[model samples]
Structures are given as structure tokens and as C-alpha cells.
Target: GQTPLAAGIAFAQKYNGTGEVTVCYLGDGAVNQGAFHESLNLAALWKLPVIYVIENNEYAMGTHQSRSSAGYPLVKRADGYDMAGITANGNDIDDVREKMWDAVQLARTESLPSLVEVKTYRYRGHSMSDPGNYRTKEEIAERKKESEPISLFKERLYKEKALTEKEYEEIEKEAVMEAEDAIAFAESSPEPEVATVFEDIFAPEDHCPGRPDRGVSSSDRKLAMAVLTMREALNQALSEEMERDERVILMGEEVAEYQGAYKVSSGLLQKFGAKRVLDTPISESGFSGLGVGAAMQGLRPVVEFMTWSFSMVAYDQIVNNAGAIRYMSGGQYSIPIVFRGSSGAGLQVGATHSHTPENWYANVPALTVITPAFPDDAKGLLKSAIRSNNPVCFIENEKLYGFKDEVPEGELLTTIGKARIRREGSQVTLIANSASTHVALASALQLEADGISAEVIDLRTIKPLDIPAILGSVAKTNRVVIVEENKPFAGWGAQVAFEIQNRSFDDLDAPIERVTGLDVPQPYARVLEQAVMPSAERVTEAAKKTLS
Candidate 1:
């Protein structure tokens, strides 16, 4: 998981003009992972200053390297990427240092990545429980006698007359005493309180109460409103942030040169230059992990995927690395990164390309999930996400990118974790987000003609759900209808419905109804796509059912 992060760290070093080199270490087994290959490819393609050290200890757990690996010499793997490959005798500390020095120099001076295969052997079993059943005891003893690191180094020092035997003995005794003292200190320490289990899950900045100022001055509001598409609005936000902060960068497939897959990053590369606006290869795991690493280095990286469906390839980087780094690091690191891309159904891109993963990301604890419905919300929420100290998953809708609306002049930043009431009523509350918000508004109009007033609530942010706003609306309407474009089972709507029933069960006059995408893969056919996704008619029927 941390393998790809090295490439990202190296990228930040280059971007910041630090001329620093990052050295990453991985076991022999980790080289077989997809992320390893992706990271190396990206590092080589970008000529990042990094060195990947693969410690080939001859075995992955109980399995021998000969059986697990196909290649003759592990160092040859570097040839695939045209990277420098070298091998070192790990048993000799001097030899290992000499080989690594060359790799480090290549990275620092030439700005190139190198693969160093350190051939080593572990005499003991893989773990404490293992009984050395994989190999014979005689083989282990023979290897230890020939190349034990500590004994070999001591012998070398003795031959050079650098140390006496008495000195070596004293050093060993001191190390043993230090280890015992550390153990005694740990034994004397008190157990942590049960209440501390939830401590340090997120940075203090993430827990900051209330959203940033979303109010525009009365004089600025008098200026003419700009009618821009969602793509233009998002582009403006990215440009503004990059101009405000030099640490902010945007990278993705087609984000530069080609502008954007949806023209969202138009004119950014030309304006910010290639250093800040990067066009990455189609390796989501690599670039996403790189973004995580960059964020760890204090650079605010906004990584874009061609589509949300493609983000599944980089799920480990997003969910594991970016989502848990702050908590796992005991709050020492803050992953202030934003992952933004198009999502939801309506693109008719088939099952592989169409995916609404707001619920998937919202389930993560340290992630801020935002699904913007209108262009203004997309621009404002995206700006807020960029400034957030926590990782944010900004889900956009391809269907709404071209939809134009009035955006106030001057700085516009919407408050996250706050829902916007699109329409107010008393009959029932229609809760939705992203594209579904438009459907809910249309359904509200249809219900109005039938004498049923429906309140439309656009939940701009999925996580940190505005429960207070939801309860307030439910208290007035006494009925609820949740609308979303996700699949039926355990979808975003399901969580919203559960929250409403759990908190306002007695306030509801009728059972809560949900209108969600059908439980099936998105189809390529236009009619099937329409039938599979939530529509205005479906939302209207669900709202009517709640009223009934």
C-alpha cells in the first residue's frame, strides 16, 4: 500500500524544487502487487527522483522465492521500465550501503528511479509460530555460519583492527541492557482508558465546528450574475485556488493538454503550467496513491479520475491510505487532498463506466463526501473541499455539467455538511442529492398540481449528514421520501431513510418511501438506462406513497 506513495513523495520533491530523493523499501512478495508495477511505471515515465529497494529474503512466508517468482534475477525486472537495476549482498552491511549509494546518487543527480534488489536470507522461521518446516535445520545453520550480518560485520571490523573483541562484547551487553530497560518501562506503564479508543481519528482541523463563511457582501451581490456551466465553474474554482496557494496542484488523465475529458480543466495547463497542472497516465492506483503521498508532504493535491467507476481501481489508495493515514499516524499527518470526478447514471456509458459511489465513500470515517447538484454548489463545494484539512470525495454528475444556472459574482464558497432547501412545503419532505435533486424538484412540481405540497431538500454533503435539517423538515412534513441514483440494496437512500426512521419515527405520519436505481447493472441501451435509474416519475410516486 505504501509502495506507490514513494512515487508521490518524489513528485512533490520535484514539484517543490527541493532536489530531494525518496527511498522506498518493499519485501520480495510486494513486487508482485499491481500497485508496485503501477508505481514504478509512473515513476519511470515521470522521471521522478526515487529509489525502490526490494529486499529479496528468498521466501515469502513459507514459500520459496524460486516458486513464487518467475524471473531468474529479480534486478532484471527494472529493465522493463528502462530503470537502473542493481544487486547487493545484504549479508554485508558495507556492500548494501555501497549499492544503495549509487542508486541514491542516480535519483538525486539524474532525477531517475532505480530498482535495487538486495539478496538476503532470513535464518529464522518467518514468524515465532513457524517451526522451520519449510527448509531443513542444517541449511539454516550453514547459511547463518557463512553470512550472518552481525557476526560478519564484527569479523570485518576485527580484521581491520577497528575494534577489539572486548569492545564488541561491551556493545552487545549495553544493547541487551537497553532492551531490558525498555521492556521494564513498558510493563510499568498504565493501560490506556477505554474512552481514548476514539481519540486521534481525525485531525483537529477536521473537527472544526461550523462551516466557513458562505455569505457574500450585499454590495458584491449587486454585480451581474454569471451564467456558467458546471465545467466552467469548477475550472474557475481550481484556477483561483492554484493562484491563491502555490501548493495546490491538479493531476489526472487528460486534465492537461487535452483540457479535460469533460472540458472541466480547460485552460488550466496553459495558465498554471505543467508543473501544477499534470496530465497523468491511465493508472488510477498509481496517480491516486501519488496524490496521497503528495498530500502527506503538505501539498494540496486534487486528483481527478476520468469517471467515478474508474476510481474502483484506486480504491485501496483512497479508502485505506488517504482515509486512514491521519488516524493511523496518531494525527501526525493530515491528508488534505480532494478526489473529484464525474459520477452517477445518465451518461449511458454502460455498467463499467457508470457508477455513483457517494455512499461507498461516505461510509469512510475520515472522508468528506460531497455530491453537488447545481453549478454553484459544484464550484463552491469544490473550493471548500480543496481548503479542507481532511480528504474529500467530490462526486459530480455528467448530466449536470452542461446545465447552466445563476452564479453570484465574487468569491463563492458553500458550507459543507449543510443541506439546501430547494423548495419549502408541509405535506412531505423529498430528500435527494446530485442529479436526484433535480428529479425531486420536478416531482415536487407534479405533486403540487395534485394538491400535495412537497419540500425539496438537496443534501449537498452525504457524510456529516445534516440530521438537524432533516429532522426539522420531517417535523413539519411528518413524511419522508428519499431519492437517489444508487442501487437499491444498502444505497445512499437507505442510510437517509434509516436516519429519518431512527430519529423521527414518531414524527412521521406515514412510512418513509425510497426511490433508487434498480438493482441491476446500468445498460447501454437508452431506454434501459432510463428504466434503471431514478426518474422524476419514480420520485413523484414515492412522494405520493409517503403522503398516502
Candidate 2:
């Protein structure tokens, strides 16, 4: 299993030997992901000079650091990884720049990762929708007046004569204009071609197994043939890919020391050393965007989340930078990056950690979302994901971490967009993914017991769905139940349910039934949590209802 910090360490190790230093800026909240720990351990172990920039913005969404963390301060935590630490006022641009420059230089010279804590303040609420009532208004006012970064930067720029008042104002104006131009251009540009919805789902048709050097030595040995879990497979794939290409790296919280929240990067730290395996603070949006910027400079970074529920913190980066950059740049650049991790509800993880992000991201024409169900698929899919020229979301399942399945030692690689038939039958079609695919298969089993043959298909790649497979299945079965772990409203399941109803109106025996997570947010209580998501029994019933 891969922990969050291992994500950051991966990249640090990859870029360690190069002249450029890789920096991951994260917030106080992000330090909690399990991967964050293992990453630092690996970074220190290998001495792969990486800078861990912590933008300690005090609060982690609704919770304050005083409430969530017991700390002397974050930079000291870096010592646990045997790394050097620097703490400075985040609002002071001079201090921030000085500290960061020092950290970068130290990393380059030492080939070791260091943590730099910038005690900054976030002026806005976590996001546009945050009501922000947790902190007192007085506290907000005080922080705004005393520690505003931009304001402090302006004062320093003026006092130090870094630029004249008139020049500073002009620079601000240009920044505003540049931001506005990007928004305007995005709004006016044509979206990706619909037919190409099928494009980039896989490598250029030429990159598949037929090419001997598409990846690794064809003779890496088919060992035990099956002692690995999906997490192991994913870890191996990442390690192999990162080793094969100097440009490839990894970033996020716990990729190194903790091995991974699920232990996905168990042996990677030993294999690649520290500079490539880095740790980040708790800022999802910040580090994700940083990964995007690094990619722009020709580094391949794998940004892992302890789980995908945290991606809400970086929806903008995923959509704007990773997804839109190539197209927005008129195809002048490519995003050789992977934002990979677990997704969906499991182990009673409440509302905050249970989001199924497929539907939200599915709408973004510039990104690719991949959901794999088994070990072999996870490994093969992730390898392909890292190799991708575009930003790729390698979404995984916390619940499925231990799920085992046989994988080929050689050429059984699966591509994005392609759908797999988990099982086959004729009476009806059950289309689903992630957890739902498991439910659907169980439902199919129950259907068999009841004499209603059903076909089970896992739409492994959520975006660039295998629509043709879906259409053909529905055409033959005349009945459908789209299953998903998200709420029914606008979740990817609804998209399929509605699209199918419209496209195959006359070929139906019953309306499309959606077996999905309940509309309520996932609950924290074990019993209540189970009550929120779709289940084997519920799916089986839905399939039976369609037959009726």
C-alpha cells in the first residue's frame, strides 16, 4: 500500500541527480496522509535532495491545526525523517524566498530532502463554497491585517526598491490581464471533438505490446506468478517506470516511509533512494498544481492522494492545469503526469472521504479518469498511466486494496477506454465499475441462481467509457441497471442510465434502474456508512426488478 508522503518522495528521487530541485508546497492539513511519512523516510534514506515546502496556513478546511495536530511545529517533523528543517514567516516574501532558495541549494548539494515551513495565512475560505464560520471574525481580521502575503510582499517590494511604485502597479496590472486572457481564451475555445472522445484512451495505437521496448525488459521474470496484491502491483509498476526513465518522479504525502496508506510502495524506497521519493505537507491543491508545473518543465510526476476524496482540494488544478494545459497551449505541450490513488467509500470513512469523482471529472474533456478493479489491471493500467502523454487519473479503491487476481507476467496490459467482460450471459446486461462492478458480478451470480442469465461488465476506464460495449450489451439484453458507489444524482451512473434510456428507448423491457449510494453524505458510523452505499443485496434486487 502506498501512503501519501511516498507520493512526494517519488518525484524527489527522480529529479535528485538533475540540476533543478523539485519542491512540493503543501498545507498543514495535508501532512496527515499516511504516505507523507514513508516518503520522507525514503528521501532521507537515499539522500536525494528534495525540498519539502510547507505552507502552514493554520487551518485544514474547517479544522484548525490546534485541534487536529499536536505539534511543536511542522519543520521539526522533518527531523523524524532525518532531514534538515527551516521555519520562517510565510507572509514575508523575502523570508520565504530566502528559506526556499536555501533549501533548494542544500538539497542540490546534499542530495537529501529538507523541510521548509512557511507560516502563511490563507485569506479566502478553503474554497468558494466554504461558509467559514469555524474561526472567529476577530481572528480572521487580525490575520488579514498582520500577515497577508500579497500585502506584505507589496510593502517589501516598495521599501526595498525591488521595483518602483509605478512599476509594481504595472506588474500587478499585467498579472491581472494575463489571468483574464487565459479565462477568456478558455471560454472562447472549442472543446475537444466528441468523436475523439475515444482518443487518448490508450497509447498511440503503436505503443502497445507489439513494440518490444514499449516498457521494461520483456524478460523481467514471471516470478511466483501471483504473490502480489493490487497495491503491490501498483507499487512495482511505479518503481519500474520511475527507474526506466530519469525524467519520471513521484510526489504526494506518504509514498516513502509508511510505504503507503495501503502499502503500495513497500519496496520502492529501497530501490530508488530518497531524491525521487518525497513527502509533501497536507495541501492537495497546492502540490497537485506544483506537479503540473513540474510536468511543464519536462519532469514526469506521480501525485498520489491517500485517497481521491481529497481531490476536491485540487479540482481546479486537475481540471485547468493537468487536463487543459496541452489543449490550452494549442497542443504545444504534454502533461506526462499521474494523479493516482484510492477512491470511494470504505471502512466507514464519512462524507469527507467517500466521494466518487468520476462524474465531476468525466465532464472535463481534457482529462482522463481510469478506474481499475483488480491487481493485474491496476499494475498494467498504472504502467500505461505513467507512460501517458496526458494528465491521467489512476483512481483506485481502498476497499479493493487486498483483492487478488491473476496477472500475466508478460503481455496482458490493458489500455484506458477498453472495457472487460468479467462474465457473460444473455438475459440482461449489468454495467458498472469500481465497487459497483463487484456488486454487479455478485448480482449476476444471484441472477444465475434465479435462472435469469446476465452479463457482467466492468467499465474499467470511467471517462472514455466503453460506450460501444455498453450499447451492444443493452441492445442484446433489453434491460440495464447501472451501478455506482456515488449518489444517483448526476453521478456517472445517472449519465449512463439517462443516455441509455434515450439512445435505446425502444429496446427496453424496463426503465434503467440505478443502484447507487444513497443521496446522503457517507456516514462515519460503520452501520450508517453501510446504509449509505449500494450493496450486493441492493444491486441484486435492482437487477431482479429489471427482469420483473
Candidate 3:
């Protein structure tokens, strides 16, 4: 996974004019991964200063390279990209150093990518558990005598009159003593306490506490309001953040010159220039990993996927790298990056293009998941997400891009874990977020026409849910209905329902009901798509059922 990050690390070096080169090492087996090719192509195309070293150790675990790889010389693969390729004998220390120095010079001076394959052999099994039964002992002894790195280096030193047999023996004795001292220290150290296991799982919360008023003050009433669409509001947030912080950068496929696939980044490239606003190739894994590396190197990056559905290709980078890096590195690094793009199923883009992944992303620990329903919330929450210390998944709805609302004229930053009470009632509580919040509001209107009064709560953030607000609503209404675009099985609503049951089960007048999308792939046909998604009518019915 880290192999895909070299391009991004090198990109930061180039962006900051650091004049540094990144050297990324990989096994021969790693070349088969899609991320490897995607990263290499991106590094080559961008002319990022990076050297990819492929250590072809003859065997990948138990299988020989001949059984797995297709090509004879792995170094030649770099020629396909019109990049420099070099090969060296890994067993010879001088040869390896001289070849690598050439690659390093090419990268630092030319700012170009190169592939250097070092042909080597492993003496021991892949791990200590396995015996060396794959090859004969004779073959192993022959390699040790003819091509062992340390032995060959010692012979070279002897021929050059740089060392004697006595000095070599003394160095070996010192090495053994150092290893023994390290083992002794480990054996004498006490075991870690059980409480330490929970430490460093996440960085301390850096953002301000959740403001119950949603950053709206009495003084803000005097401020002028502008009617803007969701797309415009989001664009304003990105522009403001980039201007405020020089470290902020925006990158994605078609985000620069093409002005975003949905026009969310219409004029940013011209304003920020190509250095701050970059357009990348259609390689999600490569660019996503690059964003993570840049964030690790102290740059604030906003990585836009063409759509959240396309982010599936970069799940390893998002989940394993971005989400887990803080814990894995023991809180030594902060991944302050935002992954934002349109999501949901209203468009006729078919099942492959439509995915409501809020539930899937929220399941991961150490990730902030936000789904804003209106233009104002979109602007405010996005600004906060850009400033957050944790990795954030900002899920937007394509259908709601053009929906207009009143956004404040000045700076507005909303808290990440707060919910807004859209409407007030006592008969039943209707909870929803993102596109479903509109459905819930419509359902509330319909319920009001009848005798039943319904309260609408728009959950602006999914993870770190505002449970206090929800419990207060549930206690007042004594009945609850959750509405969401996610499918019914193990959906986001299910988690909300569980929390309500666990915390306020005694206040319930009837069983809690959920209005969710049907458990099926979204269809391309307009009629079928509408049928598969959660509708206002379905939400109304669920609210009525909860009251009954």
C-alpha cells in the first residue's frame, strides 16, 4: 500500500520546491498489483522525482519469478513508459550502489521517474517457520559460496587491501555482542499495561466543540444572505479554504481544466493555478494514495472522486491508509485530508455508477462521515471538514446539486457532529440525512395535513452521531421513524434504531419504523430507479406506522 504513495510524496517534494527525491522499494510480486502500474504511470506522466526499486529476489515466497512473472528482465518494463531502466547485480555491493546513484541523479536533477531492478536471491525461507525444502541444499551452498553479498564484499575489500582477516573477525564478534545486548534489553523490559492498548487509536479532537446553534448568531441576521445552489456553495468553501491556507490543494480527474465532472470546481483552476489545482489521470488508487502521502507530509489535500461509486477502486488507500494510519503509526502522523464527491442513486447512471456508501464508510473507526442536506449545510460542513484533523468522507448527492437555499454572506463553519431540527412536533420523530432529509421534510408536511404532527431531524454528520439530540426528540415524541437512501439491511438507519432502542426504549409508544431504499441494485430506467429509492410517501407511511 505504501508503494503507491511514493508518487504523492514526490509530488509534495516538487510542489514545495524541496529538491528531494523519493526512493520506493517493492518486491517482484508487487508489480502484479494494479496500484503499482497506476502509481508508476502517474509518476512518469507528472515527471515527479521518484525512483522505484524492484528487488527481483528470484522467488516470491515459495514460487519462482518464472512461474509468476511474464517478462524476462523486469527492468525493461520501465521502457514502455519512456522512462530510464537499469539493472544491477544485488549480490555485489559496489554494483548496487553505483547503479542506484545513477537512478538517484536522474530523479533529483531531471525530476524524472526511473525503474531499477536489482536481481538477488534469498538465503532463508520466506519466514523462519518454513524449512528450505523448495531447492536442494547443494544449490543453496553453491549460491552462498559464489554470490553471497557479505562474503563477496569481504573478498573485494581483501583484494583492495582495505581490510584484514583479523579485523573482519573482530567486526563479526562486535555484531554478535550487539545482537545479544538488544535481546537482553527486550527480555528485561516489562510487558505493556492493558490500558495502553486503547491509547493512540485516534488523534485528540482538534476542532471546536459542536455548536448547538449551527454557527448562527443574532448578529448574523444583519448579514446579507445569498441564494446559492449546493454546487456553488461547495465551490465557495473550496475556494475560501485554498485561499486561507497555502497548504490546501485540490486534485482529481477533470477537476482542473475540465472544471469538475459536475462543475463543482468551475473556476478554481484559473484562480489557484495548476500548481494548487491539479487534474490527474483516471487512476483512483494512485491519486487517492497520493493524497494520503501529501497529507502525511503536512499538506492539506481535498481529493475528489468523479463520484463516490468510483472510490471503490481506492478503498485500500482510504480504509487501510487514511483511516488507520494514525493508529498504526501510534498517533505520530495526522491524515488531515478530505475525500469529497457526489453520491446516491437518483440519477439514471445505473447500479455501477450509483452508490450510497455512507454506511460502509461510517463503519470504519477514526473516520468522520458527513452528509449535508442543503446548500447552507454543504458550505458550512465542508469548511469544517477541510479544517478537521481526521480523515473525512464528504458524501454529496448529485440530484441535490442544483437545489437552492440561503447561504450566509460571510464565513460560516458548522460543527461536524451536530444535527439540525428542521421541524418540531410531539406525535412522531422523523430522522434523516442528505437526500432523504428532503423526503422526510415532505413526509412531515403530509403528516401535518392529517392529524399527526411529525418532527424532522436532519443528521448533518453520520459518524459520531448527535445522540443527545436524537434521544431528546425520541423522549418527546415517544415514537420514531428513520429515513435514509441506504439499503434496508444493515443500513445507516439500523444503527440509529439500535441506539434509540438502547438509550430510550422505555419512552417508545410503538415499534420504531425505518424507511429505506429497497434491497436491490439501482436500475437505469427512470421509473424503476424512482421505485427502488426511498420516497416521501414511504417515509410518511413509516412515520404513521410508528405513531400507530
What lDDT score is found at residue 337 in candidate 1?
95
Shift in Å, residue 171, candidate 2: 22
Error of 2 at 239 (Å): 2.7
Clash count list over all predictions: 0, 61, 0
Error of 2 at 244 (Å): 2.8
TM-score of every prediction relative to native: 0.96, 0.65, 0.96
Model 1, 94-211: lDDT tens digits are 9999999999899999999999999989887788998778899898889899988999999999999999999999999999999999999999999989998787776656423233
Candidate 3 residues lying further than 4 Å off, grouped into runs, are: 205-212, 215-223
Indicate the TM-score of model 2: 0.65
Candidates in order have lDDT scores of 0.88, 0.75, 0.89
Candidate 3: lDDT of 464? 77
Which 10 consecutive positions of candidate 3 have the poorest summed lDDT? 215-224
> For residues 1-548, what per-residue lDDT tens digits would candidate 2 score against the true structure?
12222333434344543455666677788777544654565557656556767788888998988887877687788878778989989878777778888887787676667888888877779999999999788988998898788877888878888868888789889999999999999999999788865544322323462223222122223443665677777877887788788777776778788777778878777788765666666767657765776676667889888888899877777887677767656666677789988888868777788777888788888678888877777887888777777778888988888887666564445566777777777878888887778888888888899898988888888887777778778888898888888887878877787778778888888988888888887889988888877887887888888877
Cα lDDT tens digits, model 3, 213-295, are: 67222213344799999999999999999999999999999999999999999999999999999999998999999999888
